[model samples]
Target: MTYSSGSLINQKKWILLFHFIIGAIIGVLLLHPLTTMVFWYEYKGLIEFPGNSPIEFLIQRLITEFKFELMPMSFVFALLGGIVGLLFGLYHIRLSGQKNLVRSLEHELAEELPLLIARGESEHLEFKSTYRWDVRQQRTNRALESIVIKTIAGFLNREGGTLLIGVEDNGNIIGIDSDFQTLKHKNRDGFERALMDTVKTSLGGNACALLHCRFHDIENKTICRVIVESAVEPVYYHEDSVARLMVRTGNSTRELDAREAHAYLSSRTTKSFSL
Candidate 1:
């Protein structure tokens, strides 16, 4: 639902009003005894003693100086009234604020998802640092590789996902360490080729057709992107044309589950039947 600007303004006003009322009530209650103490001490010659006897003396002084006859039931009722009113007001304000927060988040997500899906944001799609494909840390840090594979695979296995090689999950454009020349020097056709080959070997053709590898440049630095379309068949990576499987989950590539294998086959069979 949409909240008009006027409604939002009124909501803020109500919030402030509630806070003001609670503060006023608390201020009066806390200050009333102090005001009464001064009146009793100054006007009625009532005094409180020092140290351990201070509280006792104050109670005595208050009883003697304050003569307004109030019933225990009335005082109890009044105190309860103030406390309940204050609590209810505070709760309402907090509830309103939470509602606003949730609404704002929903609105933000609606805007962000479109951009993310379109790869519309330059900061998200383009490269930032010089390392396009360094490969210096470890030849095959299978752990890190797993995360990339998982994200890509999850994206592909669901609807589709664009894996930007050089960026973090938060859309910070950190370029991969290796570029085209770097890949060629390292005897790899491209990052996509290596990733695809790996996925194919691991998943055994389940991940192949849906995979698209490409590069984009921002500030003369190249960043790789692997786009995985929804799987019509199970894609697996093979080593030396022998089936050895890997499927990405988050940043880790693991052997496929029976469920995943079945899902791939089911999707392929359904598509073939439709065709």
Candidate 2:
């Protein structure tokens, strides 16, 4: 999403400058009278009502010579400077927020990658060795595809999460080699296409849009990363007469049967959040 003025990257210096100047203008307009009143209250009572003493004469002379009250530069500069500071401060906050988000993803990818896999599953993550084809054993297991789809559908139904294909539940990055072997292209691209096709057939085109897939080569194995965004509406895996609806709960994917599914869907609690 683009901001009010420019692209997030590339020659964006002008955008910052623009924001600062605009902020300064707004600050001046908003705070000028308020600041002036504050200074007037603070100084008028002090300077105008100097005590009748030796120091009073000196104070009177100082006021006459400096005319500090009449000098509007102080208020103008303070107002403008404060606005510019706030402008940069807000921008820095935004930039830092984005940086932290990226850092979080990087951390998630690296931290306990093996340990987490060994620990088994969680609400946000799941691991699988193959999609439908077994690379090492060389076999087609259609049930495996159902498991993958059901998990993905559940994830979409809930918080939306990561599904690592080619990694066993034991945290092994076995990769999608089996699926790759069966592919005519024998590549990550072919594997991703097949995965997408499966998703399309089971979850529909709109649901497919919520999914993003990438291939990562770690330790000479190609692990497929499937980042599923939470579906705005309900997502179901439909094939033949049966449809599987589930949600990721704790370390397991819980299939929702009719009575439970109806109560859950009827509650409509998931609407408050975005993917």
Candidate 3:
């Protein structure tokens, strides 16, 4: 007779039965007499039964009738409940770990994006050409008005960088017409005044003095170039967000993240540390 595994599992019910019996024995021995004595003393009339009643008899009858002797069953249920709770806790831990990992990845990506773009642009053929111009063709200098404030704030916060207008990433010339230029746009001297004025208004006086701005001449035409120096201490443009340090990536400017900012300060500020 080949015994089925199912029947063997059924036979294994004794494992549970053994635990129930042991638990019942302990509970009865410890609890039944104590409970009866306490109830008899506390509520004599309420607990009145015929004559001298044996605690064991009442307990045994209660166990038999109500199946309360299945102490092992109660224990098994409690154990299973504990196991389930532990599993849930472990699952929550895993989920929290995953969330932290995702957050770290996002922060790292933000830091690397600008550097990657710059590297790609630098490697391009156009960027390698000898036709580098500071600020060549100025049609409207709309970009000057648009980004001047942001550029200055970034440069002040981190290490300063060049603001090139009308020059393509590959060193190509694209001129901006005078009509498109901002009403305040002027020559080098006048441009400096304008820049200082804006800086003073937005960033306070002496803040602009911490950095410098110079205009570059290209092909006998004038284009504005501004260079700001890193502050003695880290400067914040706004209340919360650190002003993003931006550098030329081909024709575009990309903002540097925290790591790049740290590196910039380290390399530029630590000039005395050269071995």
Candidate 4:
């Protein structure tokens, strides 16, 4: 989302040049004729022409005197048009930046999830069997939600990462049907809402903006992929009255105590995260 100074300057120069060219064309083709008509109407009785009809006379004079009389007026109109073009160009650049950000996100999702999963868990990747369902006990475990939130906070506090739910630690696709059954709506929509609610309540609303969730079907089973972006400021996991800073050290989420949290924050520079 950040651009180098040189890149920004280059973009500005190109935008200005493009707009200037367009403005000059409009000035010569449109503004010059409009101005000529206004002047002709104002001095219609005072001026005499060789042609019988007014329209014929105007056209004849335009063809004959264009270079000599209209050059200065065209320059003035072109300058005014250039100023208008610059304003529009600046607004266009701002709008294009936002559009590019959206396209970047779309490109990220368009990438093959299976290929990413094949990489297995790493510093930037983690996998969970379910959101709240306990495969071992064959029941919904509310405690598992806290673990998911903790993992998200860890990624936010660190360099950011992707968390795949409905996948085993070893990368097997189990699907989240078990977790969905526990929800009232029992679908991807319901599941995403629950996940976001948990994140907002435990990790804060701002953290929810840093996470992107999507569902994909792999081998007749649906899996949820949560992409986390590093937070600009430190993020902590809130559990009742306690707040703990969790970080991803390697493949696992680790909690940092007061001194450790301070040291981590001091050593780290803020990063920009966009949805």
Q: What ranges in model 1 sit over 4 Å off?
A: 1-140, 178-188, 234-275
Q: lDDT by residue for model 1 over 1-275, one digit each (tens)? A: 77888997897677766655665555445444455456555654345443234355456544543345634433543455566666676787789789988768655743453356345423113212222333556343444554455555555544565566665545555456544445544423456676676566555465677777655554454456565676654444333465433444543335566687777568768878999
Model 2 Cα lDDT, one tens digit per residue, 10-57: 335555566666666655544543554455556765675444543554
TM-scores for all predictions:
0.37, 0.57, 0.34, 0.60
How far residue 182's Cα lies from its native spot in candidate 2, in Å, is 1.4
TM value for model 2: 0.57
Q: Rate the local accuracy (lDDT) of all candidates.
A: 0.54, 0.74, 0.50, 0.86
Which is the better candidate, 1 or 2, if ranked by lDDT?
Answer: 2
Higher-TM-score candidate among 1 and 4?
4
Q: In model 4, how large is the Cα lDDT of residue 68?
A: 69
On the 0 to 100 scale, the lDDT of residue 73 in model 1 is 32
Q: Write the per-residue lDDT of candidate 4 for residues 1-275, one digit (tens) a residue.
A: 77899998998889988988787777666666577677677777888655666577657655754486667766787877777777788888889889988877766664678898889999999999999999999998999999999999999988899999999988899999999999998999999999999999998999999999988888888899999999988898999879999999989998998899888877774323222
lDDT of 2 at 14: 56
**In model 2, where is the ten-residue run with the lowest total lDDT?**
57-66
Query: Of the candidates shown, which would achieve the greatest lDDT relative to the real structure?
Result: 4
Q: Give the root-mean-square deviation of each candidate in angstroms.
A: 22.1, 14.6, 23.9, 9.9
Q: Which ten-residue region of model 1 has the weakest summed lDDT?
A: 123-132
In terms of TM-score, which candidate is stronger, 3 or 4? 4
Question: Which regions in candidate 4 have their CA more than 4 angstroms from the true location?
Answer: 1-111, 269-275
> In model 2, where do residues sit more than 4 Å from their true spots?
1-119, 135-137, 269-275
